[model samples]
Target: MNNISNKIKLRREQLNFSQEYIAEHLGISQPAYVKIEKGVTKLDFERLLKISEILEIDINELLEKQYIVNNFKNSDSSTAIGMVENLHQENQKTNELLIQTLFSQISDLKEENKRLISILEKLSSNK
Candidate 1:
């Protein structure tokens, strides 16, 4: 399993939350939630954010590697926290870039669709 998946499962257990409860909150089936914990289902940013909210912890906690979070009670907690913060920031920037790219692609596709429609209209008029 991915480290993040393990951390999510551990946090859920720590909160004494059942898979069914989380599934209900996420509007997904229990089996689907199970797949998430098992790392069988890929987690998108939105779903990860929702899971973090449902778990009642900072999203960074979920973003952090399991080892780092586990060591938070130790003297290196600051370092661990910093690493998690850096990772979260990087993830946020990457997500922003992906959203921008997707929007650009969508706009291009829309223009192409409009051009195609116009061509079809001209062809019909000629016919």
Candidate 2:
């Protein structure tokens, strides 16, 4: 299934909710809900927000921007907090690596430009 569809299905299953239950809440048929989980139906913003409310999850979780669903079944607040902290740390590390790579690329481009300018200057001098 697609990423969003998979997230929806996973969240529903985590909540022990049936397709019929979700469909009823959405004012749609069970088949339509099934299509949503199966990635056959495209969810609009409003529908997605509704589903997120019914699932008791943040919309960003369904969009795969944040991953807090793994802690849904945990009753321990400390454990949930730890999980969120870990995710935040991981995201920070990823962002740092990305910034470093971008800076390196920029440095390389600046060196290339300098070399090209020197070459142009030499050609002009010859002319």
Candidate 3:
């Protein structure tokens, strides 16, 4: 499956969202939605438009380098070679998790990191 589709599927599952719900939101049939999620059918402009609205995510997030980097970083590694292996493993694990939506996880992590940065900045200013 295409990596993009894999990601879409993962995010959808993570949210415990049903395909029917997404399809309803997209105003598409469940089979059509499944085809989109499976990457069997290319995402036309109309579908992309609907997906962005329903997922409440900017189209950019679907193609962000930051997301790619974060996923790679979380895949534990002992060395460069090990890092590659870990990433492969992590990708496989993610595929297995029935992850429906990553926005929650990614958003929470971002908020936490933002809070940490603010604290660090404050501490630095104290000096």
lDDT of 1 at 79: 81
Expressed as tens digits, the lDDT of each residue in 12-124 for candidate 1 is 99999999999999999999999999988877667887999999988777765444445667658678778678667756754674586678778999999999999999999
Greater-TM-score candidate between 1 and 3: 1
lDDT of each: 0.81, 0.81, 0.68
Give the poorly placed runs of model 3, Cα more than 4 Å off: 65-127
Per-residue CA lDDT of model 3 for 25-94, tens digit only, reads 8777999889888878766444665676676667655543233456556554555467566557645654
Clashes of each: 0, 0, 10
Model 1 residue runs over 4 Å out of place are 66-127
Candidate 1 residue 76 Cα shift, in angstroms, is 22
Q: How many backbone clashes does candidate 3 have?
A: 10
Model 3 scores worst on lDDT over the 10 consecutive residues at: 93-102
TM-score of each: 0.55, 0.51, 0.47
What lDDT does candidate 2 reach at residue 85?
80
Model 3 RMSD in Å is 15.2
Give the TM-score (vs. native) of candidate 2: 0.51
